[model samples]
Structures are given as C-alpha cells and as structure tokens.
Target chain A: MKDSKKQYIRGEINKTGQSSSVGLIIRQKEPNNLETPFDQVDSFLTPMELFYIRSHFPTPKLELASYQLHVDGAVRNPLSLSYNELRDMPSETRVATLECAGNSRVFLIPQAEGAQWELGAVGNAEWTGVPLGALLERAGIEEHACEVVFEGADRGTPKELPIPPGPISYARSLPRDKAMQQEVLIAYQMNGHDLPQDHGYPVRAIVPGHYGMASVKWLTRIYTVREPFRGYWQTSDYGYWDYLDGKPVRRALAEMKLKSEIARPRVYETLAPNQAHTVFGAAWAGETEVTEVAVSIDGGQTWAQAEFLDPIQRHAWRRWKFDWLTPKKPGQYILLARAKDANGNVQPDQHDQNYGSYVINHPLPIEVFVDDLGRPGR
Target chain B: MKDSKKQYIRGEINKTGQSSSVGLIIRQKEPNNLETPFDQVDSFLTPMELFYIRSHFPTPKLELASYQLHVDGAVRNPLSLSYNELRDMPSETRVATLECAGNSRVFLIPQAEGAQWELGAVGNAEWTGVPLGALLERAGIEEHACEVVFEGADRGTPKELPIPPGPISYARSLPRDKAMQQEVLIAYQMNGHDLPQDHGYPVRAIVPGHYGMASVKWLTRIYTVREPFRGYWQTSDYGYWDYLDGKPVRRALAEMKLKSEIARPRVYETLAPNQAHTVFGAAWAGETEVTEVAVSIDGGQTWAQAEFLDPIQRHAWRRWKFDWLTPKKPGQYILLARAKDANGNVQPDQHDQNYGSYVINHPLPIEVFVDDLGRPGR
Candidate 1:
C-alpha cells in the first residue's frame, strides 16, 4: 500500500500563536512533526512515521555512545549514568496514548495562541522503557524535594514573541507525586524499535495519561527541586486559566480530557442512501478508561451504543465501530461520536474556554451529504 | 418530493437551559419549531416548510381582521393600525437570512443549556412587509425615547426556572436606531404568501441584520421606552457576558457574526477517491455580504478559493461551489469550508467561548472517509 504523501507537522517555534498558522506553514526544516493519517488508521498502534511529532525546538543531534543521563539536584546522591548502563537496567513495556496539550486547538474558535493542531496530534503506541520511579529509587530523592524537572538537549530562542525570552533548552517539571508514579517511564524504544531521531533518539520520557509535552523528549538531565518548578513551559505556556482561592491563575495542564473523533466517513465524503454502513472511530480518556462510546446519526438528537473493536487497555485508545442503517431518503445528515469515561466524564458538547485551546475534547460535528446515487463504502 | 419527516423545534418555556435538553426532546406538542431539511436545499431561498421555527410560548390565536398593531409609548402620536390598514400603506420585499442566535447550539461543547438545534435553525427567505421606519416615522418618536420594545401576544408562565419569573409574554427590545432602519419590517406576508401560524402569524417584526429574537412574532404592541428594556429575554437571557466600562455586564446581542457551513457531504457520507467532485455549501454575514469563500482539503494546511454560485446579495446567504479533484489514494480526508465577509470578518478556526452559546460561528469539522469502492454522487 502506498503512503498518502503523509504529513508530519513539526512545530519550529515556541512563540508562534496558533492563529498565525491558520493557512500558512511557518517553516520547512527538520525536527519532524507528523499526524497519523487518520483515514489509513485501521489498526490500534500508530505507524511510526504517522505518529505526530511536536517539537519545541530543532531535533537535537545526539550520539548515543557519548550520551550520559545526569541525575542531580535535590537527591541524596547525585549520579550520572552512561546510556548503556541505563539501558542495561530493568525495563518494562506498555501500550499508551500521548496527545499534545494543544492537540485539537484548531477547534478552539478565535484561535488561541499556540500550535494549531487538528485531531491528529494524538496516537496510541507500545513503548519499552525503565520506569522513572525506579531511577528515583536508585538516586534516593531528598524528602524536601517537591518537583521533578526534565531538561532536554534541544535549545533555542523563541523568535515570534514580542520579547524573545529563550536561549534556553526545552524543559518541564512534574509534581513529586506525578514523577513518583510507577507508570512514568524513561523510554528508550518505541514500538520495539530504537527511538528515531525526531522522537528522542536514544532515550525519552514517557509520561502516560498526560499530554505529550509532559513526556519530555531528547532527555539530558533530571533535577529534583525543593520548591515548585517555575520553568517557562510550566508557568507561561501549557497551562489553562483557573480561579483558585478566588484568584485567577494558570493551572498547569496535566491529564488528558476524554475525547472521541469520527475518523471514518472522512469529512466531505459522499455516501449512498439506504444501506448499512460500518461507521468507525476512536475514543480515549487519560487515566480513566472510556466506559461507553455512542454514535449520533441525527445531529445528536439520538445516540446509540458502539461496540468496542479492540481489547480494553488502561492508557491506550479504544477503537469502536457502529453499524448504521442509512436513512432511505437521500439528503444531508450529521454524524457525531461521543464517549463517556468510567468517571462519568462524558465528552462535552461545547468548548469550555477555561481550557483555552488545550484539552479540546469536544465532540465536533461531522457533516456529510447522503446522495441516492452515491457509491457504496468498503 | 417527500417532506422527510420535517422537523421544527419550538420551545415551550423560556427557563429551559440549553444543556438540560441534551438527548431528550422536552415536549412533543408545539407552537412548532421546524428545521429546513438542508439536504433538499437546492435553490438559494429556503422553502417555507423547511424553514426553522422557534417559539417561547404557544402560537397566539390571532384573527387577521381583528389584529391591530398598537404603536404607543414614547411616541407623540399613539396609534393602532389594523392588518389591512398597514398592508394598504406600502410594501417592500427583501431576501434576508435570519439565524436563531442559538441555531447551532448542538455544536457548542459542554452542551449549552436550551434546545439542541443543529445547523437547520437558519434559513434565507424573501420576507414581505412594510418598513418599520415608516411606521416609527408616522408615530413620531419623542426625543427622550432611547429604546423601542416589541411585544408579542404569546404568553405563559415559564415552567423550568428555579425562580419562575413569568406568566409573561414573549417580548424583546431593539435600540432606537435599529428600530428606525428602513430595512426593519412589520411583515404580514412571507414569500408572497400570508404569514404561517408557526411563524409570527398575522404580523411579525423582521429586524434585518439581528438575530431571530429581535424579530418578534405576532406583533401586538410596539413601545418606544425612555429606559432600556429590562425584560426577561433582554437582561436575564439572550445576553452575552461583556465587560463594559471596566464592569462585567450582559451585553445585548445584536448583528449576526460572519459564518459559513459546508452543507453538502453531510457527515459520514462516504465517497470514491481520485475523481473530480463539486463541493458545495452556504455562507452568510448579517447585514454584510460574504466577499470570498475557501476550501481546505488538508486539515487547514492550505486553502483554495471557491466560486460563488448565485448572485451576491447582502443579508442573504451566498451559495458556493468548488471543483475538487479528490485525492487519488483513498484514505480519509477532511474537507473544511471557510468564509470571509466584506468587513474582513472571517470564519474562525476555533470557538470563542466569550460569546458563550449564543454566537456559535466557529467552523465545525466534518469528518468523511474516502473509500475506493464508494459509489458516485449525483
């Protein structure tokens, strides 16, 4: 099968507002960002080339032979281990889904200031890595440490902002509790293959249930700080507006919101009337498994249950399909898929502005025309 | 040629929050709210039966011969004119679009509170009536009059609100300037025919460029008030959160926002790949005409111009078509249509939450699958 001249949208700047890229591609260089061609998606694991790449800066050129993982800061014993030493340590594999914090920003009207990504900025994959908590166990984190910061090798200045404030590498911090979770991994392989250049190369962080940004790629350093980490990405970007204690603040985005998208019956697809069609799509919620998936054929006036197509997993997306009998009279109709998680958190019907452009898990309406003379589906 | 089980969604109570009416239809009986079956839409004008209907109260029982439009309040000449008297005065016709401010509330995430209308709550039609300014001129408004309120005969107690504020009639207010516009109508005839009962029967106000709410149906009383109208529909409902003079206030909604929708390729309609297809849709901007429309086949990566199908008319929706060569390799493809109006107001890629659930003009995503075996379209 031929690849559909696939697209991998790699963001080149930190300051380029999403509205700026509405109809323009800002750059054409490397540090690849790709969207999994949703139409070609017939399986659970995303193809490597199709896995979306969201880079804060250019892909760092790393030499695995000389690379060392530095563990320092608020640790009882600061240690730096070579790549082989880390790879030789205990490892485990799991299937997980990672979505960019701003995955579906395109749906955020008025266009928030960030990477304008569509629904393709997410994927489920099998990752092999050593759990970060084991490393923290080896290093013996200090009791006073409250934040764990991950710093990557890539570094650059964000040129789009009114005041360029970078000259710093891409870095982020996790709360001590989140870092200590056994599910967080310092991944060295994706889908049984060594990490590709654009992805972290030799080693990368795989923080499941969190947006892709939390899984800091191109890893170089890990630091535990006594105070909360106020890194640029953590404080200024990747956060949502929140009112805490009656005061407005930027709350750092953590877990992914429950989301579902109708991947089949691609947009603008013409369909034949009066026949049974297999309508398929995918749905995922961060840590909470999606308990129910439903399909709406009449613009949400009604919804029916969709059968799960794959085995239920804790952190991976569930593939679902609905067998629908097309209305005999041909005309325009709307198809929408909605998902409800185990926590009773169902996909919202409207955009919650509090989420800004991130956590865009709204079940967007999919409009398609049914023509009596149209072709039959596969 | 069948009506396709035509749907007209009318609301019985004013207190029903949108989010509350999610999957279930609140009441079956009607003042009759109907949606124009968009698939049967072939011409520029929306057929009368297909036109959407919205009602806050049951249609008032009005006899045409006894109908009198009482123009009183801050006017120097308080006068009452019967239906025949107004019809004999003068008449004008206009092709205008009136969208329910809550037309596409289904697209609003978190499911706003009210009727969950899809895209059919809007339509363009030739409304025939006398200019409201002509009547206001004859009535001679007093200098102190700052607001003009129109009240319909429909009245009932709202059943859903916690504090039940009614046993009130359906009414709304327009600023004096809006009321004085020659384009504003006290319409008696629709599409060269008498007004339908579901619509404002004997007479209705056609406030061009404003939402349907301002076009009060069953015009029974017209009042030019010295103070702003603080009615239920004006202050407590149908208003957006606005910060004015450094204070948070509910700003009265006026004027329609720029909006475009891909009416064809109804959601989930499957189509064959590698072919030339005519992509079609409609766009409208209240008061202002749509200047240009574009289509994006690559998830908004690029946009191409689309040709307008009908003669351009202000205050009416413009039909547009694009000759698209479907991608050869059949996979899923997204087709997004966007419009820019004469005032440079373009369709937004994200939903602006500030507008709340009222002005939901965000470009919604329509997902479709391109299958190699799908049949052809008409």
Candidate 2:
C-alpha cells in the first residue's frame, strides 16, 4: 500500500454477497447489510453464510498480494504488514457475538430514522485473528497514546444524511486500554476462512464486548492518537448520551447493551392451542456475560426461567430454551425475553432513547396467537 | 404592537436596570439577563429590583398608545385589543413564582451550556393581569386548537447559536388545556406598577405554575395553533427529555422543577463557631405546591424539617427557615436544602442533566466554613 490518502478510493456497493442459500434478511440493499434469520440460528457458532453482515460503505476491492495494514501515529516504530504477514503472526480464534447498535429499532415508538431493523442483526461466530496488542507492541506504542483509531479501505461519501459527510473510510477508535487488550483482534479469518469481502477483506477489527460498529471492516490503517478521536462518526453518528463529570454529553458508541431475543415463537407467529412447544432464544451482554435468561409467557406479568443450551463463553451469547405447554384456550398471548447480566443490569422494560436509533435493547413484546389449526413450531 | 412584524423592532438592552440596591447578579450584559441574589431574598415577594430577569433578546420598546394585542390563528373570531381595552377587562392579581429553567446551572459538573446561574434566577412576584383565557374566549378558539402560542415583540437573530435563526420573536406555546386555565395571565402590570421595560412593559403572559419561558415577555400576539408549536424556542432552546408512549424524546420546557435554595448561610459563607444562626431559604414547585422543606445543616447525612414562614399559596414559593446552632468545633460545614412537593416528588441529590442545562433541580451542596474570628451574623 502507498500513501493511504492517495490510494483511498470510495468503492462501489457489493452486489454479490446476497446469497439465496443463507436466506439472510436484507435490511439495506446498497452497501449490503444482511441479517440472519435469528429464529433459524440452531447452533452456537452462527454459520458464516447465515451470519449477519453490516457495512457502512461499499466493499473495497483489495488484492491480497499488495494488501497492507499500516500501523503508525504516536508510535516509535511504524510498520506496514501484508495479509500473509498478519496471518503468520500469533493467531487465536474465539467465539464472540457482534450485534448492531440499532438492532431493535423497529420497536421504537414514533419511529427513529436509520435501518429499521428487528432481531437477527446479531450473530456469534469464531473469529480467527492476531491480537491487535501484538501488532501495536511490535510497532512500539507511545506513552502519550490515548486512542487506537482503525480506518478501513472502504471510503465513500454517505449520501443518506441531510448534510452528507466528507469521503469517509468506515472507521472507529478504541481507548488505549481497550486497544492493548489481548482479546482485541486484527482478525484475518471468520469461522476458519479468509476474511470475506462482504465483511472486511484481508483483515478487520474484531472488538469483543463492544457493539459491531467498533469493529472496523476492510482494515487499512491502525494509528495511535495522542488525544481522543473526534471524527464525525465518533462524535455525530454512532454516539449516545453518556455522563462525564456528572454532565450529560454525547459519547462515542461502544459496549453492546444486554439483550435477549425470542428466536422461536417469533412475533405474530401462530401456534396450535393445547400443544407442547419449545421457546428458544439467545442472550448477550457487553463487558459482563449474561447470567440469567427469563422467559415471560404472559406479557411480562409472569416469568419462567429458561435453561441454557450453549455453554457460557466470555463474549458469546448464551442460547436458552423454555419448554411450554400451550394454553387450551385460543387467544392472543404476549411473549417476552429478558436477560440479566452478571452486574445485575437487567434489561429494562424500556431503553433510554438518548441512544437515538441505536441500542434498542428493551424487552420486546412479541404478540403470538393461539389457534386450533395452527402448527406448534412452524 | 400594531402590525407586530412591521412594528417589530428588536430593542436594545436597558442599561439602567442594574440598580445596586437590588444587588441582582448580571448573568448576561447585552440582552440583560439578571439573576437575583437568592441569599438576600428576605421575603416571599421578591422585590422588583431583586427579582431575576431572563431575556432572549433586547428589551422591546413599545408605546402603550399604539399597542395592540392580536388574537389570531385557528380562531373563529380574530380580535385585536388595545392597551386600555385589555386594562379595562376584569383585572386579577395573583402571586406566582417564575423560575429560569437554567437556574443553578453553575453546579453542574463539567458544566453545561447557556447561563451558568448559581440559583436565584427565580422570584415570586404579585402579577396584575387579565386571564389569557378571557382573551382567547373572546377570539372564539377553534375546537382543533392543540396549542396556544404566545409571541413577544422581542425579536432578534440569536447570535450565540452556531446557526443564527432568521429574525425571530421570543415565542412559546401551552397545551390547549393549560392555555384555557384562568391562572394563565396576560399582564400589563408588575408589582402595582406599569410593567417595566426590563420586565416586558406593555403586556406579557404570566403562565402560573410553568417556567418563566412559557410566560412570554413583551407579549404581542396570541394565536391558537392546530398542532403543537415546533418553534425554535419551544424545540431547540428550551427542551427536556420526556417519554411519550414509552419513547424518550425532546419535549418543550414547561413546569418549573421542585427546588429549595438556602437564602441564609449561603454557599461558602463564613460563620462564627459556637453561635446560633438562622438557616432560612425558599422552596417552590410547579403545578404542585411544596408541602415540606427539609434543611440539612451537615450536608445530606441528616436533615431537620423547616417551618414555613409564609402561608402556602398556589403557584407561589413558600419561604422556610430552620434554627441551627453552629457546632462548637466546626471548621467546615455543608448546608443543604431539600423540598418535597405535595405529589411526594422529593428533591433529588442529582438531577438528570438530560434536561440539558435546564431544570437543574438538584440538591446543591453549599459548603460553609466556621472561623473563630468571623462574626456570627456575617
């Protein structure tokens, strides 16, 4: 790679990743943001073909032979490593879930703008990559470094906003402490395969314990900033109200909020009356793992504990299932899934909309109907 | 106020109101926003000179001879009233406390934007006026009216904002129900005198139980709006987070928050050790009158009930006092006041800054020190 400024090109939208086999729900057509059918998620490791895809811009066309990840800015040693070089570095694979901040935006009353997504904009997968700390260590980080900013090759002027931003390379910055963590990865593979172009090609950031927006795709540059990054995306978009020194202010989006989704018995799905049924779902949290998944079968008036099918991992969502004997009477019933984190941060009945159109992690009311002719698990 | 737009002249600020007798603290100079020194508030009626002044623009200059109040918009009968005609209408006198939403903003950590007032941007004044409801009734308000907008003659392009709006009149709206309330006033007088230039001379709206902003000064136009008013003053400037159908959104600033201010033993005041001092203050709340005021002589660790000096009055602040004996060995002491409303809404230790520099109704910590040489009354 040459000068990033000179080589920067705002690529075109990817039209090839919408594979019919995955049956992924397309939240957006251009830039290719596809969601998995969360109800169909049957395993701990979300199949690569069925995993959710979120992109801020068009997929950049980069050749592996010439691809290089540049590590500079506030560093004693600035180095550029090729795709093979990154792959040859100390590698680790771990299962982590990535959920879009705006996952349940469709549930917001008065409807907020931007990606009206429901559930399925989340998935857990085994990401194979080199710890970002190793690359930063080799680059010899500076003491004054405060932020590790990641800039991707995908650059485009976002045309959706009233005042479009300048040509932006989908980027995000991590605090120096988070960047130094061994779990923070410069991922080269997804589910034991080379990074897919539909995702980030060659390499991308896999930020565990954070929202997917923090995981910059189509990686091209890693820079240590002496001060906090104030990019438009960091300040304007993908930010929420955070208190600093007891004053409410806009803060860059980070940690994914605790959430639980009822994968089975989907919203408005029909079920047979007086039949045995299984209610299954996935729960996830940031920083702390979700410790409890309670399924409420009566519009949150009463709750029944759900048993975890998948073993708990550091950053993976736990799959929980609840066995239910459908009521004999035919009527409308509301189902809700609520997750509690290790810190006792229970999913609130309502989320503070200060998060704007993002972090819509409130307990969703999924109204399902019971009818005599309806199938139990259709 | 004939042909308000044509007669609209954004008057220059009055420089003569900085009377030293009142000792009012000037928060802003050009547009004349003065805050009362709450510690000196010795009575329930905040003296005209001591009362706070909040203005978005310069003091509008108007001639009573030519003044005309226009009642239009969503009304069956649009009428204009002359100054004498409005004064001839059934006159009423009501004592109501008006408070700036940004009062006590200086206490906010990391600080917030707008006026950095340290309490005392409030005052209970005896308002002499005609009920705005009477004027609206004569105008025959349409059934579809959702809001009653009050527009003051004060008009200017607010220079402080990054995007200065086009020449705009200071305007705010009340819900249809609140507008028709007899307590809502159209005043041409203040404290037994013709309204002073600094305090909206010819006529103004005295929206009892609401913040001062809703009481539009220099009021020139009264209009019934079919939809909720989305003017910049109602939307951009004075707004707080409110939940509608369970979604947090920007809501126009309305009712003043419950508050208690220590009039005596003010912030950082020095007191003599082993001496008895009267801890006196005032407490006020909107819609609901303050039922109880608690004084904490040693910060908030312990509290003692305060006795009301003035009889409780609707829409008026209640003056409260507590007898406190200075600790014998006191080197430093923290004084705090907490008020609980009739609705049981107690003053919180911390206010939600989501109110955004407004509704700063937090229990303020007033640090006072005891010195052996300091005079007891000092």
Candidate 3:
C-alpha cells in the first residue's frame, strides 16, 4: 500500500495473514508475539480482544477434567455433560452478536450507574456448539417448567448481604421457549479456537440477540424452573433502576435497543482539500435485522442511504458504507450515521426513559475536515 | 458500625490501611482498596497507582542516576537538575486536579468522533515540587518567548504523521499568567513520597486546571518557544473536531467546565423499605471554586441544597453530600446531583458541540432504590 494520504483504508490481508485494517485500541496489553486472527468483521464480528469481556470475577483457570455441565431441577431426567461430551454433540454454528447491556455506556451523558465501558462492549462471533434445544430435550425438561437458569463457574469477591447469604456471582433466567431458541448454544469454541480465558473457556452459552449477561460465561450449571429466577446477576443487579422520587426502582430486563458505531474516518484524521472518501461502520439489533443505514454529512438534517451488508439472520449486524465526496468549502463537518431495523424503527437522537445505560438508537457523529489545499491559485 | 441491611457495607480495612468500597471503579491492574486519607487531589496528582499515566511510546525503565531535568531554550542559564538537586529546591505542595480534555466523554452520545473514555481520564492528587516559573526565573526567560514547551521521558510508537516527530510523549503550554502561577510546580514528590515509576518518578509538572496531557509524566525537558509549539500532543491530535458539512474542523483547547461524579448510590443497589441515607459525591471545575451542590429527587422538578465541604481552590474538587430521607412510597427514584461553580456555571443537562472530547458538565443521575416492605395482609 502506498504511504501517501489516501481516501480510505479497507481491511485487507497482510503479510502475517491477519487483516491490515484491524486497529488495536490499546497497544499496552497485546500478547508478546502472538497475533490473533479475526474473520472479516464486515460490521458484525468483533475481534475477540476487542469484544467486550465482562467478568464477575477475574478469568479463572479451569481444567476440562473438573469442568462439568450439570442439569437438574424441574427436569424429568437430570443430565450432566463433561466438556468432551458437550463438544462432541452435533455442533451447530450461527453468526450472532452478544452485547453488554451497558455497551457504549460512557456515551451516557449525565453519568448513569454502572461500569464505564468505553464503546467496545459488543462483538459478533461465529459460535459452534450444541443446540440449546437439543440439550434441553436430552435433559428431559419437565412439561411444567417455565424458565431455565444458566450458571457460571466464577465466584466473585463477595460483598455483604442479609443474614444467611450475600451477593454471589451468578446469573439466572426465563421461559423455556426463549431458552430453547435454535440460536442459543452451549459452546466451547469462539470464532475457531478454544475460548480465551477472558471469554469463558471450557464452555458458555451463546444466546443470540440478547445482552452478554444473558450468555452466562464459564458455564457450570443449568436448571429448569417453574417460576422466574431472581439471582444476583438478574434481580438485584444488572437490572435497571429508575431514579423517581429520588430513589432507584428495579425494572425488568428488556430486549436491547438498536445501536451502531463508525470504525473508519476515526475522529481527527486530516483530509486533503475537497477530498472524497467512503465511510464504513456497523450496526446491530437484539432480535431485529438492520434494514438500512443512513449517513448524514450535515449532522442529522439530511441523510443519504448507505449500503448495508445483508445479515445472515435477524440477529446479526449489518455493515454499511457511505461514499462521501470532498466538501466544496474548507471547514469542519459532522458525519452522522443512523441505522434503521426491518421493523421500521429509526434510530432516535436519544432513547425513552427506561434508558438506564441500556438501549439507544442515537445516531453517531464523526467530525472530519476539508483543508484549503490552495492549489497554485486554483 | 452496625451491620445493617440498609446501608452499603464497605469491606474491612486491610493491613495496608486501605479500605475497599463496594463500587470503586478500579482497573484490574490496580489495588482494590479505595481510601482517600488526603482531602484534596491535585490536577496531576494521581495516586502512584491511579495517577493519570500517559505513555505515547513504550514505558522506559530509567535508572535514578541517569535521569535529569534539562532546562534549555532561549534562556541565559541553560541548567540541568539531577533528581537530588531538584529535590533540594524549596518544595512547594498544592492539591490540583488534572482532567484529560476527554474526561466525562461518554456523555457525548450520538457517538462523537474520537477515543471513548467514560470518565476514567480524570484524577486528583497532592503534588509537591519547585515552581516552573521560579525555575524559568533562574534560567532567565527570553523576552520574545511566547510559549513554554515541556516534554516527557517517553518516545511514542510510530504511526502515520505530520504526526509530529515522536518519541513524542506529553507536551503543553500556557499563556503567561498560567505559566507564572506560584502554584504551577515542577513536581517531584507525590503525597510525601518520591514520585513512583508510573508517575514520572524524578519530575513532572503539576499545572493546575489544565488537562492531564499538559502535565507530562516522566518529564525531561522544558523549552521556551517564540511561536506555539508544533507538537502532536499540542495539535493534529487532542484538539476538538467539528463536523462542518461532514468534514472535521479542529477546535481549540479551553478551560474545563464544572462536572461531578457520584461516589456512592451505585447503579443497582437495593434499598430495604424506608431506609434513610446520605448521597455523597465530589464536584470540580477549572478557574473556579465549587460553591454549591444541588440534588434533584424528581428528575429536574425541585432541587434541594446539598452540604458542601470546605471549598478547595480554583482547580480542586469540593466534596458534597446530600441527605435523602426514605420515601413513604415504595418504588424507583432517580437521584440527580448538580453542582454550581463559584463562577455560577451550573452543571448542564447537555453540553455543546464536542470536536475531540472536551470539558463535560452534565448532571450525574444516581439511581437509588426504596424497596417496598411486604405488607402484613399479603
């Protein structure tokens, strides 16, 4: 590639066999000499290192011999699977995304509650594992069961709780139908390798179209229940709290709202006078497929439809690219990108109330410049 | 302290004399303890562990004997001070607060162009050192000097350029008055100890009210410039960009705005019905003192005055507290905290256009809960 200033640098194969365009957010912690290969991001797949790795406790070292997937409670035939057994099951592969409910939370002005995950908290993974439905069938879930709970192997540093027990590191769950979706999987591999420790190795459930919290990492136990599960990761924490009357009230978990992020034309890249280039980005939804992506060179006043890469399903992200011609004038410009889902839901400037660091279809803006090249008196 | 189910239970103090708060935002690399024995925080005085360490290049392991502060550039006396010589100067101490231009950046929703920092970029400390103005006086500043340039010990990694010749670490300048402020110290001591390795052990400047970038850590050189210093840290980066007709225009650096952070009442803390407690937090601004803090229980309807601790000075944060009585009704309530600086600049619900992240003064929403006590009839 020529080193001269160019319009855009698309992800291309490099000498090391890794994509050239994959940028590293933090160079400090990269592995010594190992380069992690990633599939074409194409707007959906988040590089594992870049993918949000949310851990209750620090990533634990586990041995496959001791790792077990236990199934009990409300199941006609309780079943347990060793790591190998689960890996041997007829594997199902699906391209889906897992986003933290608190993704892009730093953008939450007026500072809301929770972890300050700068923007990289969502990722697309091609998960290959046993179908959740098949696993439930083998376990013989009781006809009366209403919910299935997935637990992780992590044990958090405990804080105090009421008399008997305290804040434990665990997550629970919902309706049998929701748990049995074909998109849901009990996986041991992420992308193509054994899960990185930071990302639950051994095994974890990849529940497509939901928050990462729903996809319990370091999978350990699965339980069938007739009533709602109120574990710490569910009820008392992670849940939304409304600050009404000077206090917080817990709100039920809702499907994540739509969101998008621009990967190219990074914040302060200088452009030659009146230069034109194509801008690229990715957008995703919890369940709905992104149908269109709109790019606005003038903030949000006017927007032109950008090209959207077709999704493999309703759960994957759609990559979009907009061709931007050089501005006629030399000044600052805000590029706004907004994505609309198939349901006709256009991204909003901000989300409605229940927006506790959760969903927002707000259009993202990227500012660029057009210099006065002052070409020999034009 | 009685172990009550009502208030949060902070962890037991460790032998190191550090107390662990339930929700202190700490990096995995940092100690879990979160106690502040010192009341004031300097702009550049990040704790040895929490100090805002900016590394443009790789961190160098410098031997104490090899490190020296070089003072040259348009001066009658080009002097170099060994670490010991610097320590011998009349050491002055001040509490200053340094915020990155991008502090509270997550607030710039609709995703602004640039790095995403969720408020982790700000820190305070008690810095002790010789004044830069005094040092310049000893070195004899030239009459034509317009800007003072300071450089760090780091050599930035290679990337594309106009990028300014790097090994470029941190650098910044100030108008005459700021540079001459008696409080503007070339700090060598942090909290009564030799500056740690991560915090420019032998020396670094403590420029109150300026962004962290200006207080170059591992500082090594100080130069006077007749024109503005053309360095990457100064321009072509860090500057704000405006999207003018879809193009980016650079914005200038200015004073920071008033902003605050909730120290307690974390995101999903559950409240036992009818529990009374105090909501505590800290507020800061540049060039002004924090005068008053207000609490809003009903979103923004009515506001109540919060008790402000003793006022620090122009560039220090003033801790504030608000007592919230238990609500008669059981539900969710949003606790909003806003502060007004002595300049009468109150925290805004939303801020103006952000090119690169700049001062953020958005109101912080603390989600508190007033749980419903089960009724006897039920």
Best by TM-score: 2
Model 3 TM-score, 2 decimals: 0.45
Model 2 TM-score, all chains together = 0.52
Question: By DockQ, who's the top model here?
Answer: 2
lDDT of 1 by residue, B48-119 (tens): 666778888888889987989999888999889998899898889987888989877887778977777777
Query: Per-residue lDDT of A1-378 in model 3, one digit per residue for the tens?
Result: 132112122244211334345553431232211112222344245555545566666566779998789887788888888888888889988888777776666567777555555445667777889988888899899998888888777765333110113224455575688888888888887766678787888888888887777888888888887755544444334545342222222343646678777656656555555556767777887888777788888878898988865543767777777777868687888887887777999788874444445664577566777676555321
User: What's the lDDT of the predicted structure labeled candidate 1?
Assistant: 0.75
Best by lDDT: 2
lDDT of 3 at A3: 28
Off by over 4 Å in 1: A1-31, A159-164, A374-378, B1-378
TM-score, one value per model: 0.47, 0.52, 0.45
At residue A221, give the lDDT of candidate 2: 92
Candidate 3 residue spans exceeding 4 A from truth: A1-44, A158-167, A241-249, A372-378, B1-378
Sort by TM-score, top down from the best:
2, 1, 3
Comparing 1 and 2 by DockQ, which wins? 2
Worst ten in a row by lDDT for model 3 chain B: B5-14
Please give fnat for model 1.
Answer: 0.00
Predicted complexes: DockQ each: 0.01, 0.02, 0.01
Query: Model 2: which residue pairs collide?
Result: A101-A359
Tens digits of per-residue lDDT for model 1, A182-230: 7899999887788878789888999889889898998988888885554
Q: Interface RMSD, candidate 1?
A: 17.9
